[model samples]
Target: MSDNYAASFSINQPGRDAGILPVNQPGRDTSTSEQSHTEPSANGGSTVSTRENVRPGVSYLAGRLEFEPSIASKLDALITEFRDGKSTKGNTVFEAYDFVNSFPGGTPETRKFALSEFLSTIDSVEILADAARRCGDRAQIGLNHADTTATPRIEYTANAPNDNALIQAASQIGSKRARSEALSDADVGPGRENDMDYRSGEKRAKLTTADLPWHSEALAARQDGRVSCQATQDLLYRYERDPGWVRRQVIISGVAPPTIPPGEWDAIFRGTPVNLDAVFSSVHHVLPPKEDVGRVGSTEIRFSNPEPSKRIQTANDWTTAWDDVSEATAIAFPHRARELKEYGSYIRSEFSAKMPSSHRKIILYDIAIRNFVQGGQRHLLTDFHLFSRFHSAIVAPDGVVSGSGSGTKPGSSSRGRAGGRKIDGSKSEVCHRFNDVGRTCPFSTASCRYIHSCKGCGSTGHGQRDCVQSGRDSRSTS
Candidate 1:
């Protein structure tokens, strides 16, 4: 069985009290000047003392309880034994040492608990010295061996209390103390030479390194272009095997296309051009005829050509010309055109939802502007403008008109209503004053311009069902 040992203890200065003293009066000596300065002499006589001669010991243990709870519980038993007069010694270091050593393995955790309990009765330094003496006695056989390597690993075995789990808990407690005052491995217990297997049967605890934050930061530095990807990967693998490397590789692959020999480009682009013209012609033949002037409402109404020319006359015009041809062909074709339009609209709506609103608006605006410039139609631009104006009116401060008029300034009457609404019974007053003026009072009318109002009461004064005065009147009548 593996040996179990908990961390040891170190003395530190206790926390200071934060309470403030009462204010001193003008004649009061707040300073230590008027106080008696005397010290108790070794011979039990008074001696002259100064502030410089005074030194204070730690008032509280500035450390954590190092033992597991189970081992610490045993201290209560010892305390009971002491109270019952069954304990052999009284208020001595040897008594604590003997009590702790009685455990099957005087593991560090058990020792620490014993020290804490002993200090509750005696002093910390004395308890620590006693523990060291006890450890020295147990390890005495191997102490004088000239072969420094020949040391038996003490195996802690007992079921009454287990300290194994906490013994391997990382060194944060010991590291918090100053290096000089820190507990050494020797203070805990001698490490096992033959007891190599340290695996615990309890749930396996994850081992986290102290420098994890630094490692993550280093990887981020590489991602942000401070270092090469290969360098980052190497650094990461040095600490732990991470699956994130695969994701990083995929991202790098996407951003940078793999290099291909110049000879491959010609072969790739040599394929025959798609017969877009034939496709458009076939679509035009199968489509319904354009609407007649009488059918749509005016004799002067002329439908523009449903199919644009497909051939690209200039390099700059190719993309625009191709797009127009494709669009016109789709509009002319009946079944396929309707299906394509619906599918395209669905895709655009989904993409718009996923994209930021600002980005979506910019894209929509660009498409509308392009359609207008191409002499396609004016109604699309008109719709775009209306939508943009409505969106701005809802979001922009100046776009929001406060009054019935379209002017940007907040109306004087609106401000008056807002101020008057705070007064009791002002709802009836405002309604009588404004009802005939074609401006409904925000207080009493259902057609009130103010958005925040109680729908049930038809008044801005208070909610109908929760009215306190109404409830009181009902109770009185009952």
Candidate 2:
């Protein structure tokens, strides 16, 4: 309430409080009476008056208004009337400005809040003016405020324009004048030559965009779209960024500090605030999100704005994810890299051949990726059927798969079951594992369903490991 408008607001003072920012107070002059930033006397000392620290009131918004300046000067008179218990008589600027100033202004945060609310009011006023013009109401429209502020501050009461006795008296005077002159419908001679309605004549053609002001360069640039958006991103690389000392301090404190809930604010005011200076530094190595499905009942995952860093990039491409992965893979592993290539091909064929975008199937593909093309879970040679000739390839030659991280152990007998007594193929069919014994493979003990029997003449007693048949009895393993 003093002429100093709170001496704690040491705005524009350099040494002790130079680092304190102006918050959202744009275009404001804040040279303190304590120090002169601009002019100096011959004695090398300040000549700044007490007026330097004096509050500008509505004059603070003079050149700094974000909207029309028409009603700006009227604000001083109106708000003065409001503060001194005089009537504003339903002027909007007074009520709104008083409401804004009614907020506590000791802290930069509260001042910033007041500025933001003021700007919002100005914007609403602009929008209202536009609507008023559109509705053929030429009177300059002001803010029709929501009553969160002014009504509580004063004994505010609504009085309609029709309720004023002066307005009724004015209307009566106008009616008497109309009767005296009988104008707007005066008697004239019947023979009138001039056409009163210019619209009744040959109509003018409606104008196209060609008739209006158009910037061709801007239009061309929009169509071309090679220009970068140049939108500034908050990467939290804040310190050591600003050239000015004040801005750097603002970064350390905060610029537009996050709006807190009422309870949180109360707690903050009561308790000590944690001044921890963001210990963790940001790194470039980022992982894909752990869970892509952000919400329940929605299979499609939507991209959200990345926090901590406001970096945003957008693109539309025709190629699928499979194509991109495949392209990267070939560069990492060449064509001769049989294992990786086989795995890639298998995954593509199973899930993304026609590129069916089923998320569940992609999950299955991820499971299969853990196992390679040479991952050994092959069928035992004892259980070999029509598929034996197909298995005789590079990855695993024998039925015992090397490095088989699976249910079957390597080099365990398919026939070496039932407490180690080898049962020949007297009761059961021939073991396919025995079929490959002498020629191509040595028998490895892996679990098999078929019995160890001879391929020739189905004899289990004579040929257990080797088939002695030479003439007219050698049959194929297939």
Candidate 3:
């Protein structure tokens, strides 16, 4: 009859509980008389609890688990230490668990299938630490991951033509038959086809006439003289005593020098023969004197005794006979005929006695026939002889006038005989007939189109100094 349910049967009474219910304790007295039993809340409270099934945890089953039996048994012992290709110290704990299962959210699908299963397990770590230091003690402690075989195959062959036919029949039966009997007892030929006589003892001492003691005095001095200057100084002192014989007589007689005939200067000044008509009348008395003298016909001349002489005829004998006597004295002194034929080729080449008597020979034949007739044409004396001797230097009878030199006064002006007057104060007689024809400036007159539109900014026809649309609109509105 001790009925005090010590504050709700003290945790379902498992020990210090010797007595307790009696009010008809039948099924906890009919479940505490059907209803009311509330006294246990001082923070140690629980009424009938046992819940705990909340799963989705290890961070939600760590991305749906699987190959993690400790990283699939350290990737099956690092794919069996790379299929037994050795190196172990737990292969850096299987490469730090294969670089933390190659991250980006470790495995499942992210670590690109665990970095392609850890790069198909090895073929590197320096070839598995050089196959574990050359696989000492047959190293492979485990990793027959179901031995799927595949990697070891090598094999090569080829060099067999019966091992090069038994090394070419044992080098043709040993030491190549003693190097073919020491090259057939040293006659060593058969290969570069013979002929290396290397002067077979000086070409067998040049074959005859008592072995060459001057081959019978050079065959009796080539029968008297077609060659004798003492047999060409004993064949040029035996061709300079032989060795390479003056480069084989300068490669067989072609070294060059012999030409000779420019009229052989009369057989080179006749060391004794003279009289070819007394050497052409002593060189035609030192030459220059042949004036207008007549004939015009013959030319023969030849001589150094090869003959042909008799035809001198004369007038102007030929080779442009002093250019036909200076073109017939420049057609008969038409104004000192090219100063007397350039003073006859400068006194026939004694260069007019070395010039300066005010360079006379008629002033070097009037400056060598006025540089041989104004070299590029035009100057055959013009301006109607100073208007036929000055009719006030013929002012505008259609202008022209010219002359002023060799003894002046043909209408004055090379600045002399009180010359100055002409500028005809312009009534456009074409600017006073272009200043009486010495034309200084009617600027080619069709009234000089305002002097040809003022030649651009010396102002008129508008050359806005290279305008460019007034300089890009004055640089875009300044």
RMSD of each: 34.2, 28.1, 48.7
Per-residue accuracy of model 2 over 72-188 as CA lDDT, tens digit each: 334444433432224532444446545445644333333332333344333333333333322333222112122122222111111212233323332343233222221111212
- Report lDDT (Cα) of residue 400, candidate 1: 53
Clash number by candidate, in order: 1, 4, 1
lDDT of 3 at 88: 51
> What would you estimate as the lDDT of candidate 3?
0.28
> Pick by lDDT: which candidate is best?
1
**Number of the predicted model whose TM-score against the real structure is largest:** 2
What's the distance in Å from true for residue 184, model 2?
Answer: 62
Cα lDDT tens digits, model 3, 1-478, are 0112111111112233434332222112122211112222234331211111222111111111223334434444554454443445346444744565453342232333333324433322222223232222111211121123324311111221222322332233223222211111122211212323321222122232335577666556545533212333333333333323343333355431112111222222221111222223323344432222233354334423433232121212211233433332232123435544544554344333432211122222333333433311122322223223332322223323322111223443332111232212111111222222132444433222112221112222222232243343222331
TM-scores for candidates 1 onward, in order:
0.15, 0.16, 0.11
Assess candidate 2 and give its lDDT: 0.30
